[model samples]
Target: MAGGLVKYRHLSRDSAHRQALLRNLVTSLVKHESIHTTWPKAKEAQRLAEKLITLAKRNNETSRRRATGILYTPHDLLPKLFGELRKRYLERPGGYTRVLRTEPKSTYDQGASAILEFVDGPKDLRFAMTAAAVARDRALGRKSNELTLKNRSKVLRYRDNGEKAFDDMVKRIGKLDLAGVNKGGADKSGEAVA
Candidate 1:
């Protein structure tokens, strides 16, 4: 009865399972701005994530609700996705996410691993936290600052893994020369006095 109508990958899972898998993958990708997954899965998740990001670019009540529906994670990333993430990608026409291939865990699996990440999403702990902060304010609809182990551990891991890179960069460059920063010598207070 069915013919030529199959448009999406099944991921070797039943309907419900596949839907859940894609949802979780996309959720993680959006929340953390990166996710390590197998090639096929990464591609599928990227498709969905890209669609959602385009939707986010609309930056409206409908888009927010729709993205919230698709990325229905407990942490409620809709606000951040619609606000910060949307703003970041507004100027770009498309290609919101990138897929970077990495070595597979083993040759037997014959599956390549890839990292799916947002093009301009946060790459450091401080900004990552800040990106999610404004959304958190509206996402939770409350004043409580409590968090779950999964989220707490996620942020902790981000901080942990990012520290090495931060330290290495500081050692390599002494300090980053952000644009608009004064190239002149610093004053006695070690501030850019121009």
Candidate 2:
């Protein structure tokens, strides 16, 4: 069994706890459109969340029943799940969710962290990041690099009038005085500069 393929991470929890945990994560994801958690839990919950979106896309009785079963607050979420999310991802085939890794929340905790999010929504991190990249390049009087160009195209691929939205975001971010932004008055050395 040492060389055998593993199916999924157990996350040191038994089956019931794991299911409930994933259900809660997915429910919160539906409610908020994004969530931050430990990387393994994000990965596992991403799987279930994607399947639930697929069910929502299907928009049939069986799929609705399954989605209801998976979500903790189905009464509150079923409408958004079956209506808004369905319309949002209708044309896309798969990959509804994304997982981006991050540093641990604090120095004392070293577990790998990640953000699990539904893409193409109002709170899309990729879209915002790509727009920032474009704005930065423009502010520097330089053309976008290959990676920036690729990300720009990718983030704009699905949304309605994505180009316009990207342009608007770029314009808005371009107007910001990034040099004046600070981390709670802390400068490079974590000393007060305000």
Candidate 3:
């Protein structure tokens, strides 16, 4: 029945090549806090990224060595990974990385693409999306829906001073011309255009 089969995507690469590719991806992810790539690659990298974060959280010699082995530029990234990222994710239990499917980034490659990012970081996509939703709801004079409410909670759950951050984002988005109000700086209700 193949009940205990070890499953992993090969991504059309030999073992050594695949390992190197994953290491590079994880290194970039750690440096930038987010990365965009093919869905399969992003999914595979997410596994390694989660493990790296777990290692950082441990903050021990063996864990640091293991993480260094996985990362390409350990010298440049180790401090950030062990210090900032470790502290950032210390409170969370699991699910450190998120893979969000996106349209193909290039016309040549029609394959599914995605963005891989760490949760609760400054560049969290879901957080910005949730704040935008809240702003739109306010601008439209409508209450937030159940899904929006749930997403809001998820975005704010682990964040420190989440309410303040969310309010700030909503205000920032509100200042933009989100709805039909004053489109293109014409001021739709103006008496005349000079």
Candidate 4:
């Protein structure tokens, strides 16, 4: 009735409930950048977030207090948010928030759900650094595997040559002939036959 369709009273019908809902929505938006809720709540959250961003862009004491009062964020974080983030988005106009529709909930009045989130800045440098570290580790692992294989092959070659050396020694020692007679057969010195 107030803003078309059914508005989410969230049980209570007082100003406290509205303020509490707004604070909860803002906190969730800041922490996760997205939240799923009923359509009206999502729309309300989007409107609130846009206003907060506008105030953040202003970067003044009055604006900070006003935004903090509405969103219930910590006063300490306001300076950082305004000083750093505000300057970054000075060129941009509005549309600081986005809403997306999600699956409908089966229970709790079967309300259709949607997600609200803030549009953040570009990709962080740490992500690229982490990727580089992973690639370096993978390369090192491959090199270590290759080195292990080479060492194993060298050990196997040594073992094979050692076996061949033992076989050569046995051949040089020759076989004993116990069947021969002891009375100097053919050669008196008992030398082997040519």
Candidate 5:
């Protein structure tokens, strides 16, 4: 009820989910200087990444605090943000990042995906990859094959007693191959293959 008028991508997730997405994307962008994600996600992360870069440019206590609240770990994030990235882009007057579309689209959702990278940065990524890939690439000073799961479930759901019986029945039926195997009985088709 508080923000009923507000508008944002639902992404089939609740408020907390959206916020977490933003935080992770921004963090990745800072650490990697580039990231690949769905088109919509890239667009949304661009807004936040630019703002964070602007804060890095400011390089003040208050700005650092604001960034840390969103970024987590002021010591780690703020230093690199205000130090290296800030120095690199200090002369630029905004438009800090660019989103380039990945040809052939994405395999996951079949929606357009993009690589969002800092201006005057690397531009020849062969595939659209997750932010974790970008981070690993940075750490290794070259691309790495490592992958990290982003959306891990925080809640566990258990079936009730009634549901458990149906689940068990389905599992048993799944293993009962319907053809090309003997079940200690004749074919129920009332016929045989020659």
Candidate 6:
């Protein structure tokens, strides 16, 4: 007897329905780098997309096979995703996607609507970490002025000369002694400092 048994099912049960959903979701994600959807589907797709990215990160034959199996996409596209895209995100440890809510269409479905998207690369991580550090410092009642100044200079340098410039700025800032500076331009040694 099938007593107390329950069969699990999906919202889109048919093959055509499922395939359409997957294709459209994947295409939208690739083209726009984000998409808005119902909370349940968005969460599921986010898991799938991250898995694909992890496969891409591996960049090997096995990973290619795995991605092909999971995504059911053309093998040719794997190289671009795994080679160029993977390299771009090499330094990031995960949480590559972000979800931000938007206004709902109806009160009945007024659950959290959100946009899920990829965060470009490790550069975003640096910016996020810097922001977090500044916030933490402020919360702890410690001086974050030095970090703020250093991050400002780094941002300016990056805007001027790109990632290499930012790297150089970080190195230079790391070597500095920041205790001497006050709210004014004068150093502890009573000298005008840049």
Top TM-score prediction, candidate number: 3
Where is model 4 more than 4 Å wrong at Cα?
Answer: 1-12, 106-108, 120-194
**lDDT assessment of candidate 6:** 0.60
Judge candidate 1 against the unseen true structure and give its global Cα lDDT, from 0 to 1. Answer: 0.67
Candidate 2 lDDT over residue span 48-147, tens digit each: 9999999998999999999989999999999999999999999988999999999996679798999999999998999999898888777656798999
Model 3 C-alpha lDDT per residue in residues 79-99, reported as the tens digit of each score: 999999999889999999999
lDDT of 4 by residue, 1-194 (tens): 46676544453447777778877887677555567788778887777778777888877789878877875555645655577556655655776666767778666677778767654332222222233333333333333345444533432342324334433432333222222322334333577544
Give the residue spans of candidate 1 off by over 4 A. Answer: 1-6, 106-108, 124-194
Could you tell me every candidate's TM-score relative to the true structure? 0.59, 0.90, 0.90, 0.51, 0.56, 0.51
Candidate 3 has an lDDT of 0.90
lDDT per residue, candidate 5, 79-193, as tens digits? 8888877876687778777888886365666888887887644332322223334333433345434332221110001212323433343344434533323334434464453
Order of the predicted models by TM-score, top scorer first? 3, 2, 1, 5, 4, 6
Among all candidates shown, the one with the greatest lDDT:
3
Lowest-scoring 10 consecutive residues by lDDT in candidate 3? 179-188
Q: Which 10-residue window of candidate 6 scores lowest in summed lDDT?
A: 153-162
Error of 4 at 63 (Å): 0.6
- Candidate 6 error regions (>4 Å): 1-20, 72-76, 105-111, 121-194
Write model 1 residue lDDT over 1-194, tens digit each, in one string: 75778788788999899888999999898789988889889999999998998988887778777787788683478778877788777776787777878899578986889878876445533334333542344333444255532443433442334445433543333233322222355543568654
Candidate 1 local Cα displacement, residue 61, angstroms: 2.0
TM match of model 2 to true structure: 0.90
Residue 162, model 6, lDDT: 45
Ranking by lDDT: 3, 2, 1, 5, 6, 4
**C-alpha lDDT of all candidate models, in order:** 0.67, 0.89, 0.90, 0.57, 0.63, 0.60
Model 2 weakest 10-residue run by lDDT: 177-186
Error of 3 at 99 (Å): 0.5
